[model samples]
Target: MPTETPRPMRRQILTFAVVGVINTATYYGFYLLFLIALPYLGAHVLAFLLSMTGSFFLNARFTYRTRPTWRKFLLFPLTNAANFLITTAGVYVIVGVLHHGSRFAPLGASMAAIPVTFVVSRWIMVPKAGTA
Candidate 1:
């Protein structure tokens, strides 16, 4: 268990959304920067890693109101991997395989992955009270 006290689920959800907004901003900021500064795939990977770090810290401390622990920390990267694969596969299916890389295509596909990532990240990356 970590030092931080846990908040209620509703408050936790709100906090999670707030942190998500910040993390999304960070992800996109880095994404746009990477597009301008780095090459293809490099930009996406770099931004994804950086933004994931932000999400882990924010969600752990603020959203879930839990202290950092080895289990939680270790689980963070794995949750990120889940998010990355889900996001990538979604984007690829829409943009690459489906040939629907237009305005609504990416949005439609990405919508499928967001809730899944949130649920998994919430359950996996945050510590529960009185657990091992």
Candidate 2:
């Protein structure tokens, strides 16, 4: 009988952070492109949704090394519920309330939500112990 090695939390965190960087770059590129045709909030929402779709796959494949399933995919957005709320508020505060530009608002907004996102995403993407 073979025993599986335990996965390291530190390694998983590092992988998640790398995936985040890639997702952020992808999101930023889309946000900038969308800004050309839409308002900041509109562009933000569209870009956010699109990048989130990509993020799901990236996290599944690399960060967690889990198979992507419809159940998980459906629940994936819940992982970002806090992230979305936090970043949206942060962006609003920075860009609307503080008079900053849309271009950099999301980058700043995204920082605070990382820890929460990691926790929630892991819960949502990975099956519970003794199950699945």
Best by lDDT: 2
Cα lDDT tens digits for candidate 2, 1-132: 997645666667899999999999999999999999999988889999999999999999988889999998999999898999999999899999999888999999999999999988888877682153
Query: Which ten-residue region of model 2 has the weakest summed lDDT?
Result: 123-132
Cα deviation at 115, candidate 2, in Å, is 0.2
Question: Candidate 1 — which pairs collide?
Answer: none
TM-score between model 2 and native = 0.91
lDDT of 1 by residue, 1-132 (tens): 777544576787688778877877787678678777675346667977898887888888887767878787777887667667776677567767887733343234445566666667777855452243
Best by TM-score: 2
lDDT for model 2, please: 0.91
In angstroms, what RMSD does candidate 2 have relative to the true structure?
4.7
Model 2 residue runs over 4 Å out of place are 1-7, 129-132
lDDT score, candidate 1, position 95 = 60
